[model samples]
Target: MPDHVLITGGGSGIGLAIARALAAQGHPVTITGRRAEVLEAAAAETPGLFPQVMDVTEPESVEAGVAAARAARGPILIHVANAGIAEGRSLRKTTPEFWRSIMATNLDGAYLSIRACLPDMQAEGRGRVIAVASIAGLRGLKGAPAYSASKHGMIGLIRSLSEDHLGSAITFNALCPGYVDTDIVTRNVESISARAGIDADAAMEIMVSANRHGRLIHADEVAAAALWLASDAASSVNGQAIEIAGGQV
Candidate 1:
């Protein structure tokens, strides 16, 4: 049997793509999401993908989901804290509620997921934790201050944990991608169009152009990065923010 991998937000987009890729490589995968139907649908389409209903924003939900996943496939050897929300707003329009919401899902969620899985990882003496961050995390992304802050917080959490576990068997890392072609990007494009009075296609093009290569990224590209981080090749790649952003800095 292969090692068990738990991926939060694995019902769709990059998370689901990573789960499928890992399962194809013989890993027993548990994919979690806030909606049971979404998770079940994803699991139905992908062999070896187990569905778990979880809301990363809620600690109770994360605890229950992790317990269920561990019960199904022993201790989780790979934990991907990939659940997050992305939104963009200027400082004048940003409200405390919106900022908190993004931080709750993107930063606090990753922290809680890591905390929930670390005990078992420590007990086992070996594990991998990957957070799906973004190039926005590396620096301010102009309009998405809240989203960028949350991502920055995630990298901060991962780096701190990596330092704490320096000599231990577990490793932590983050994948920073730019303009990945996911539903989130689509939604963001629509939001931008509405806010900036540009056409939807133009908004999308603007985002794609942000990448140095002038193209949108594939979900599989990010998934491949996750697989690399989880593989034996990345044993020494701890505390790194591996960028997949077509030269976006």
Candidate 2:
């Protein structure tokens, strides 16, 4: 059997896109999320997608989820750390609870998930670890200190891991994208509108204009980058953050 691929936050958005793309490539994929209904529904709609309800923020949940997935499928050869929350708040407005929450889900979650699935790759001597980071990781995003910091930490982790396994077959890389046209954007439209006292269209336009091409990026675009990074062709693309921001970032 071909090695299985495990993706966190695979119920929707870029995670779902990457899950479907990998599944269509004839790879058994385990799609994980915090919501069982969402995962089950997504798995039902797509073939070769196995639903594994998990909270990546929790170490025990990640370990158990991967073990269960391995029992059902084979060893996981690809691990996509795509589970994260996107929210922007000024440094003065950021609270301790909010900061910890972002770190727990965005940074700590990736660390735990990779640590759990990496052994399978070591046993087989080959694997792909793709993290769905953001351009904010490459540069601090204004008004979103926690989110930016979390993603920066995630990319740093990927870079360090690639160096730790420099001569190994396992490859570690990150995909840094600008504002994507996902549910997050939809939610952000309303939040930004309310926060900035602007109309919804204006708020949406602000995000749409954030990309250099003056349009929101499709989830498939990010998925394509991930697909490439997960392939043998990307064997030498380790410790790098490939930007897919519609134009140069």
Candidate 3:
């Protein structure tokens, strides 16, 4: 087993929850994000959590950040590519810039993060790569074609990597969670309300209704799936996109 775990976009939401869960299990956790303040605050509150300011969209930033994290906590035995941006834009309104922005963060970010961590993992002959994808990856989301595409790309990357490393100690998988109760959902509520000219409560209901259980999934629920995937019992569970969307997808 590896001594250290690294999580991108770990300052808040699902990433933070996974970091905290691993830390509770005695892993030295390094959390990286673009915001120094948020990372610092999260680290301050968590005993085993360390913070690194990294923009996953930038290659140099990812390389340097991964080096710093490795130096701080030793080789990253587990990596979570969780940094992403979710937006709701109709296909007709989605601009080139908007599509690229979402792809850069959700797809390119995961690629960079995994690439930076793979060298050490391969050298050690064992590691875990868990991507925090979404239900959008599995099916079309009504107003988020770009976001859906990005997540689909993420799942594709994970699946391809898993095949490349087949029979090796390393494993790669993706967590596809449905509407989670997080700041992203909060922001989306406002966006949905404005876009549809509806009240915020009604906009929230639209999201809530997307889940088969008629409610938002919790961050910890996704975190638990991540922990399970990282365990030795899941060594054979490779190249899979595990859904946590209350049977939505």
Which stretches in model 1 have alpha-carbon errors above 4 Å? none
Candidate 3, residue 118: how far the Cα is off, in Å: 0.6
TM-score of each: 0.98, 0.99, 0.98
Summarize candidate 3's per-residue lDDT along 1-249 as a digit string, tens digits.
Answer: 336999999999999999999999899999999999999999999989999999999999999999999887789889999999999899999999999999999999999999999998899999999999999999979889999999999999999999999999999999999999999999999999999999999999999999988999999999999999989999999999998988847
Please list the C-alpha lDDT of all candidates, in the order they appear: 0.92, 0.94, 0.95
Error of 2 at 73 (Å): 0.5
Report how far off residue 84 is in candidate 2 (Å).
0.4
| Candidates by TM-score, descending order | 2, 3, 1
Residues 1-249, model 1: lDDT tens digits = 778999999999999999999999999899999898999999999899999998899999999989999998889989999999988999888999999899999999999888888888899899999999999899879999999999998998999999999988799999999989899998998899999999989999999999989999999999999999998899999999988988848
Model 2, range 1-249, lDDT digits (tens) per residue?
Answer: 666999999999999999999999999999999999999999999999999999998999999999999999989999999999999999888999999999999999999999999999999999999999999999888789999999999999999999999999999999999999899999999889988999999999998888899999999999999999988888888999989887887
Residue 121 displacement in candidate 1 (angstroms): 1.2
Worst 10 residues of 3 by lDDT: 1-10
Residue pairs clashing, model 2: none
